[model samples]
Target chain A: MILAVCLNPALDVTYAVTALRPGTSVRVRSVQRRAGGKGVNVASVLHQQGVAAIVTGPAGGSAGTDLTAGLDSAGIGHRFTPIAGATRQTVAVVDADDATVLLEPGPVLTNAEWTAFTTSFADLAHEADVVTMSGSLPGGVPGDAYGRLIGLAHAAGTRVILDCDGSALIEALHDAPDVVKINEHEAASTTGIETDSAEGVFAAAEELHALGAKEIVITRGAHGVAARTGQGRFASTPAGTVDGNPTGAGDAFTAGLAAAMAAGLDWPARLRRASAWAAAAVAIPTAGAIDPGVATDHETRTIVQELPA
Target chain B: MILAVCLNPALDVTYAVTALRPGTSVRVRSVQRRAGGKGVNVASVLHQQGVAAIVTGPAGGSAGTDLTAGLDSAGIGHRFTPIAGATRQTVAVVDADDATVLLEPGPVLTNAEWTAFTTSFADLAHEADVVTMSGSLPGGVPGDAYGRLIGLAHAAGTRVILDCDGSALIEALHDAPDVVKINEHEAASTTGIETDSAEGVFAAAEELHALGAKEIVITRGAHGVAARTGQGRFASTPAGTVDGNPTGAGDAFTAGLAAAMAAGLDWPARLRRASAWAAAAVAIPTAGAIDPGVATDHETRTIVQELPA
Candidate 1:
C-alpha cells in the first residue's frame, strides 16, 4: 500500500465571478469546493490511475469534517488524526483574466497532537511499502517533521518520496528520503543556486544529493524534468507545450513517480511515465483530475534521454 | 421579549491584507469571523444592551454550526431550524481604503425546510410580544416569506417590525406590519419614487402607508431620519456624525425601535432612542457592538421635531 501524508489539508473553494471589483460587492457566479493539499492531490491522482493509496494526516474542526467527507466521496482511504483546531480553506476567485488565490493559515497543531500523529505515522509507515510525505506543516509543528517521518519510514523498511520546499525541504534532506521531488524554482530556492539552465539544474540536483537526497527530480516547465542519482542522470522532454491548467501537474508527477517506484520501473521509464502523467494532468481543467487514457497516449510519445553524469 | 428572524444567516469572514492583486496569491495578514445577518445583528445589539431577545431562523451545515457557536458565545438566545443545505458565507477582503465583499449564494431552502421554519416561527412568535423579520431570503424561499411570518405574528397578537427591501418588502407591505424600516435608497426603490429630499422621503413614507404599512421609518444617513405614522409625522436629527464602522447601524436602530415599542414609548421617543442607538453603533468598530454608555449620552440630547402630517 502507498501512504500519502498531508500535514496541512484544506477545503479548496473556487469562486467564479464576472469581475472582481476592489471596493464593491461581487455576487459569486458559481462556487466549487474540493478537498485539497499537495499530498491529498497526489493521492487523488493515484486513485484516478487505479493505484492504491491512503491519505493520512492530522485533520480537525468543521472544515476537517468536509475534507474527510470529500476524501470518502472520492474513494480515497484516509486515517487522519483528529485535533482540536479547525482546518484551513483556500479560496480562488476566478474571473475573466484573473485567478486570485486567498490562502488561509492552517490550524496550529499542538505538541500533543503532533505526538499523536507521530504514533499514527509510525504504524502506517510500517504497513506501507512506499510512503510519500508532502504539503506544508501546520503552524506549531516542528520544521523537521517530515525528516522525522522519513526516519520512521526508513526504520520500517519503507521507501519515502518527499515533495516540499525551502526550509522544510532543507531540514528533511538531512534524513534523506529515497527520492526528492521539486520544481526548478524550489530547487533554486532550496539549494541557493540559480537553476535557469540545464547545467544549473544538474548542479542543484547534485547539491541535493550531497545533502543526503538519494535521488533528485527537478521539474522545469516546458523543458520537462531532469533526474540525477548515484547510478546516472536522465532528463525528459515532452513533444511541445500542452496548453491547459497547470494547477496539479506537480502532484500528478509525484503520484506518477511514487507509482512507478512501486511498479519496479527503471529510472528512465519512471521519468518517462512521470512526464507523460504530468502532461496529461495539464491537459485537463480541474485540479488532480486525470484521464488515464490520455496519460497512456502521452506515455508512449514522451522522450527520455540518458545524460552524461 | 423580542423575536428576531434572520432568513439568511452567514458566517462573515474578514481577511485583512495589504493589497489585493488580481491573478496572484494574497496571504491573509489576519482573519476575523462572526455570526452575521440583519436580524442576528439586531439580536446581538439587544443582547449587548441587556435586553431579552431570541434569534430564530433556518441554519444548517458547517457554517451554520460556526454561527450557532458564535451566537452562544455572545450570550444571544437562539433556536435555529435545521436544514440540509450548508449556510452561506460572506468574505470581505480588507485592503487599504477598500473592503471588497464577496457574497456566496446561500444554499437553496427546500420546500420542506421552509415549512419547518414556519412551524418554528409560529411557536417563537406566539411567545414573543414583538417580532422583527429582516435580511435576504435564501434561494428557493418565497419572496413573501416575511409577509407570511407577519400574518403569523399578527395572529398571535404580536407587533411586527420588518426590515427588508426590494420585492420582498413590496410583497410584505401587504401584511401592514407596525413598522417598516429601510434606508432612504431602499425606501425610494421600494416606493418607486425619488427620495433625494425631505419632501420626497415623506411622500415615499405616505405611499408605503397607503400600501398598508402602519408606520414608516426612513433612515437618511447623516441627514438623520424621518418618520410618518397615523399619530403624526416626526423627524430626528442627531447632534453630529459619529465616525466609526457604519455596517450595523441599521440593525442597532431596529433593536432600539423594538425595545422602545415594548417600553410603550411614543413615536418621537422611539425614533429618538433608535437614532441615538444607531449613532452609538457607529461609534464602535464592529457591527452590532453598540456601547450602551454612548447610546444613553445621545438619547436625551437628540433633537426631535414635529413635522407636518
Candidate 2:
C-alpha cells in the first residue's frame, strides 16, 4: 500500500461566484468543502483509481473531524495525529472569469506535535510500498522536516516521492528522494531559470536530478508535463484543453505516477498515465480527483510524444 | 432561562488589513472567529453578563461544530439540531479606515430541516423565560418560519424578541412579538419612513407598536437609541463617541434588554442597561459581548439622557 503524508492539511473551501468585486458583497453561486493538502489530494486521486492508500497527517479541531469523515466516506484510509490548534482552512474564491484568489497559509503546529507526527509517519512507512511527503510544513515544524522524513522512508526500504516547494524542497533534495514533482514556477525558483519553455524546464529538471533527485517531473499547466529518469526523458501532452478546474492537477499527476510505478509500468507508460490523470483532473470541477469514468476515458485517449534523449 | 434561536447562524470571520486592494492578495494582521448570527451573539452577551441562556438552532458541518465549541467553551448553554447542510460563514474584510465589506446571506436550509428546527424551538420555549429569534432565515426556509416560531413561543407563555430584516421581520411583526430590536435602516424599511431624524424614527416605532409589538427599540449608531414602550417613548444619547468595532452592538443591546426584562427591571433602567451594553460592545475590538471588567465600568459611566415623554 502507498502511504501519503500531508504535514499541513487544510479544510479547502471553494466558492464559485459570478464576479469577485473588491469591497463589495457578492453572492456565492456554489460552495464546496473538501479535504485538502498535496498528500491528501494524492491519496484521494489514487483511491479514485481503485488503489488503496493510507493518508496520514496532523489534523485538529472541528475541521480535522470533517477531514477524517470525508476521507472515510471516500473510502480512503487515514490516520490523523490530533494537534492542539485547529486545522487550517484555505478559501478559494473562483470568479466567473476563472480567476481564483486563494486565502492560504493556514493554522500553526507546535514542535511536540511535529515529533508525534514523525513518529506516526515512521510506523506507517514500514507497511508502505512507496511514501509520498507533500505540502509545506506548518509553523513551529523544522524547515528540514521533509528531509528527515525522506531519510526515514529510505531507511524503511520504501521509495519516496517528494512534492513540495521553497526551502523545504531544497532541503529534501539533499536527502535524495526517488522522485520529485514540481510545477513550472517552483522549478524555475529552485533552478534559477526564468523561461517556462520546454528546453528551459528540461534543463532545470536535469539540475534537480543532479542535486540528488533520482527522477524529476516538471508539470507545465496546459502544456502537459516533462519527466526525466535514468532510463531517458519523455514528454506527454493531453489531447485538448479539457477545461473545468486545475486546482489539484499536480496531485493527480503524482498519484498517476505512483500508481503506474506500483503496477511495474515502464517510465514511458507511467508518463502517459500521469498525463492522462492530470488532464482529467483539470477537466473535472472537483478540486482533488477526477471520477473513475472520466479518468478511464482520458487515460485511453491520452497521447504521449517522447522527446529525443 | 432565556433561549435564543439563530436559524442562519454563521462562523463570523474578521480579517483586519491595512488596506483592501481588489484582485490582489493581502496579508491580514489579525483574525478573529466568533459565535455569530444575531441570536448567537445575544446568547453570548447574556452569558457574559451572568444570565442563564440556552442557544438553540440548526448547526452542521465543521463550521457549525466550531460555533458549538465556542459556545460550550464560553459556558453558554446550547443545543444544536443537526442539519444536512453546513452553516453559512460571513467574512468581514475590515480596512484601516474602519470600512467593512460584509459577505452575508449564508447557507440554505431545507423545509424538513426548518420544521425540525421549529420543533426544537418549541421544546426550548417551554422552559425559556424569553425566546429570541434572530438573523436572516436561510434560503429554502419560508419567510413565515420566524412568525411560526414567535407564535409557538407565545403559546408557551414566553416573551418573544424578534430581530431580523426584510420579509422575515415583516412576517414576524404580524404575529406581534413582545419586543422588536432593529437598526435605523431596518426600522425605516419595515415602517416605510426614510428619515434618520429622531422624530421620524419615533413615528416608525409608533407604527410598529400599533402592529402589536409591545416595545420597539431602534438603535442609531453613535446617536444612541430610540425606544418606545406602552408607558411612553424615550431616547438616550451616549456621552461620547465610543470608537471601536460595532459588529455586535445590537446583539449586546438585545442581551441587556432581555436580561433586564427577565429580572423584572423597569423600562427606563432596562433601556439604560441596554444602551450601556451596546456602547461597551462597540468599544471592544471583537464583536458580540464585551468583557465584564470593561462592561461594568462602561455601564456605570454611561450618561443616558431621556427624551421628552
What TM-score, computed on C-alpha atoms, does each candidate reach?
0.96, 0.87
Cα RMSD, each candidate:
1.8, 3.6
DockQ of prediction 2: 0.37
Clashing pairs in 1: none
lDDT of the structure predicted as candidate 2: 0.81
Error of 1 at B303 (Å): 2.7
- lDDT tens per residue, model 2, B1-309: 999888878888777777766556566666677778888889988887889999888988777988898888888899888887887777777776654444544667777888888888888899998788888777878778888888999899999888887778777777898888898999898779874898898998888888777888888887878889876777776645677888788888889888888988877777778888887887777666675655666666656555677
Q: Which stretches of candidate 2 lie above 4 Å from their native place?
A: A98-100, A183-185, A193-206, A219-228, A232-247, A290-309, B17-20, B24-30, B95-105, B110-112, B140-142, B194-199, B220-225, B291-309
Q: How many steric clashes between backbone atoms does each model show? A: 0, 0
Number of the predicted model whose TM-score against the real structure is largest: 1
TM-score on B-chain, cand. 2: 0.89
Worst lDDT window (10 residues) for model 2 chain A? A96-105
Q: For residues B1-309, could you state the per-residue lDDT of candidate 1 as single tens digits? A: 999999999989999988988889999888788999999999999998988999999898888999999999988999999999888999999999899999988989999999999998998888897899888778888988889999999998999999998889889988888899999999998889899999999999989999888999999998989999767898898967798889899999999999999888999899889999999999898887897877998898889899865
- Lowest lDDT sum, 10 consecutive residues, model 1 chain A, at A289-298
Clashes by residue pair, model 2: none
